[model samples]
Target: MSTNKVIHALYNDDDILMDAVKKVRAEHHHIEEVFTPFPVHGLDKALGLAPTRLAITAFLYGITGTAVSTWLTWYTMIADWPQDIGGKPSFSWLENMPAFVPILFELTVFFAAHLMVITFFMRSRLWPFKEAENPDPRTTDDHFLMEIPVEGNEDELKALLESTGAVEINVVEKH
Candidate 1:
């Protein structure tokens, strides 16, 4: 559980809020989190957060899916249950391989998509059948919020927020 008290600053304009965040980070160096209704360009650069790992995970998942699908199809069709068709010899790996390509492609796509979605949700802390923890409902609709954790000098923090053109400010004790 977190014990830091957070001060929330709400802004209607994302550009102003982004500037405020950069200013606050430059001045205070104690921002906890910022929440916005939608993706704001250049916000991640301003925050100095590392680039996302989703793409890497997705690529690995795609490779795994492709390999698994290919191996499974080959093993089942050629190795395990070899059946002669159209007077062609059974167990001819190259000859029967084309027939597995469609199913292989489908499985690869399916696994890549589904696994990437799972990875995204897990990494983002978002999941189906889970309640959202949106601090302000408006933060989901229109407002952008910057949450700065107060470290004994809240007055200065409040001043910094005000200087950044925060439309509203609220402080809550986190116990």
Candidate 2:
């Protein structure tokens, strides 16, 4: 398989990186990726990327959590152990629902939190023992890295990047 060629531009400041992204998109160039030491506010909008669907998935996970909590509570308290609940003889699940409110809240939050994290990791292709794909390690410290795909316009891209205050530029041939 053939690998893609891309221009990797390094920026010392987030402001410069943001401007470079806007300029690159304005010129109809696609940015493959950007790496930063910390989250850059509104950087996603500047990059013209689509909004994430994680929130929708989180909603579904929350519903699942509520459902599971309801079912487990019913099976454990009302079905098998139809005895003392909340220091009283509970005859129905609805009567004992107030006591289970805290459990319901905790389980809902737990499932949503745990599942959302797992989903994010799976969607981002992050897993244990994976090698880093960052072109430069400095991005993890202070620098920001932007990768632009090369389609035989290396000189033009380099010039544009340099004009946007890129500190370092490299034409990388990756496999």
Candidate with maximal lDDT: 2
Candidate 1 contains a number of clashing pairs equal to: 0
State how far residue 33 of model 1 sits from its true place (Å): 1.3
Provide TM-scores for the models. 0.90, 0.95
Best by TM-score: 2
The digit string of per-residue lDDT tens for model 1 on 1-175 reads: 8676889999999999889989988884667788998999999989988888788877888889889988897788788998777766666767777777898788888888999888778877897788877788999999999887787878888888888899999998765
Residue-pair clashes per candidate, as listed? 0, 0
Cα lDDT tens digits for candidate 2, 58-143: 99999999989988887888887787844855668898888778878888998999999999999999999999888898999999
Task: Compute the lDDT of residue 7 as modeled in candidate 2.
Answer: 92
Per-model root-mean-square deviation over C-alphas = 1.8, 1.3
List runs of model 2 lying over 4 Å from the truth: 85-87
lDDT (0 to 1) per candidate: 0.85, 0.91
> Which residue runs does candidate 1 get wrong by more than 4 Å?
87-89, 127-129
